[model samples]
Target: MYTFKFIPRENIAQIIPFLQILDVNIPAETLEQRLNEMFDNNYKCVGAYHEDRLIGVSGLWILTKYYIGRHIEPDNVIIHPDYRSRNVGDQMVDWIHAYGKANGCVASELNCYTGNTRGQKFWSSQGYEIKAFHYRKMLDNEL
Candidate 1:
């Protein structure tokens, strides 16, 4: 089993180049801004590194209803293409689930593009159900 460590945003600069190699295209300035916001907002961000190279990232955000609330939620999950098929995604998700459980979340939600069959299958295999369906149409702004 490969060891996974949760690195903080302070070290995120070191991972940006690796994440870029994975085709993650967010600008460094944008990423820095986001990282600062996450830290200031008390959210948790984790990166999985192997031998000083970041191979995966999971961004988590806690959600609440104000009246009725959940303690934890995961916002994003991505594993480098080269690291796929080795169970890194599964392990990272499992870790996030455990974090939610520990924080008393009743449920966790993740949004994936409708046409991403691989993502749908993966989430299904991980025991997530299709609880809701949404349809949208662009009203305008086509150029």
Candidate 2:
């Protein structure tokens, strides 16, 4: 069995290695900068552990937007490759759902990359529906 808990910001680095499962390939310095920025933005990460080993992580943000009232947005969800098909994702998501409810979140939202078909199926199984496309443009960087 796995256990879930929110990882405190001070120990956020623990999730860094697990990020490799998501194909995170960036300079160490840049990744550190971005992670610190996320920490400053109140990003909360939940970790799924087996005894003493961290096996999964998912980032979350509880925000109140005009359209969604209050919602929990999940991002960077990745399970360790070694533990992928053992229900770790399901339990981690369930933990997030319960956390959101306790924090008064009215909805949950997430975006799965187009090429990640497995991720899409997992989210669908977790009761998420695709409502709209998330479009982005580089406003300050070269395309």
Candidate 3:
């Protein structure tokens, strides 16, 4: 059985392992520092637990955009490999939706890698449709 809770910043460390599973290339210390910085900027994390151990996590950022108005954007969603195919991700998504509505968000948005067909399918099942392409470029030197 799994339980869901809004994790506080101090307990954010508990999410490092799950985050690593999603992006193994990130250094642990860098992830920790970044999470802390996000928390300082109003980012929130919700976690799924099984028998007192965190097994999944999702991070949310509340922001206002002209296209969507006030919205909840979820990032860094992950479920431990051991717990996949058991609806944990669905539950987290459900929780995020409810939370977004309760907090006056007009919409919820998330980004999924184009290659992650399985994840895209799941998001589609949850009523999300692609609206735009996200682009990024890494700077080799300070601007």
Candidate 4:
């Protein structure tokens, strides 16, 4: 049986390994700091657990944007590779939607990498529509 719960600050260390599986290039040392900063803002995270182990995670950013009005932006959704195709992702997404609605969000939004067709399909199946293109330019050196 899998249990879902809001992950707290002290327990964040337990999520590092699972997050690394989503983006292996992320520096483990810096991730905690960044996550802490985000948590201080409007960022929220939920985790799916099988007993004491984390098996899936999702993040949400509560924001008020001009175009979307007040909405919940879901990000960094990842399920353990071993647990794919078992509707775990769907359940996590469903939880996100319900959470957003309960919080009075007008809508839910997210961005997926253009090359991730599988992710795109999954989001589409969850009733998310493609509304805009997300472009990014790294500012690490310029800043």
Better of 2 and 4 by lDDT: 2
Q: Point out the higher-scoring one by lDDT: 2 or 3.
A: 3
Q: For candidate 3, write residues 1-143 as lDDT tens digits.
A: 78888889888778888888767888889888898998989998999898898888889999999888999998978888899899998888888888899999989999998888888988898899999998878786421
Give the poorly placed runs of model 1, Cα more than 4 Å off. 14-25, 66-68, 133-143
lDDT of 4 by residue, 44-88 (tens): 889987788788888888888998888888788888998889888
Q: Estimate each model's TM-score.
A: 0.75, 0.92, 0.92, 0.91
Clashing pairs in 3: none
Candidates in order have lDDT scores of 0.72, 0.86, 0.87, 0.84
Candidate 2 lDDT score at position 110: 89
Question: Which candidate has the highest lDDT of all?
Answer: 3
Ranking by lDDT: 3, 2, 4, 1
- Evaluate model 2: give its TM-score: 0.92
- TM-score for candidate 3, please give it: 0.92
Output the better candidate (1/3) by lDDT. Answer: 3
Error of 4 at 11 (Å): 1.5
Per residue, candidate 1 scores C-alpha lDDT tens digits across 62-102 of 78766437855555567778898889888888888887888
Q: Indicate the TM-score of model 1.
A: 0.75
Candidate 2 local accuracy as lDDT?
A: 0.86
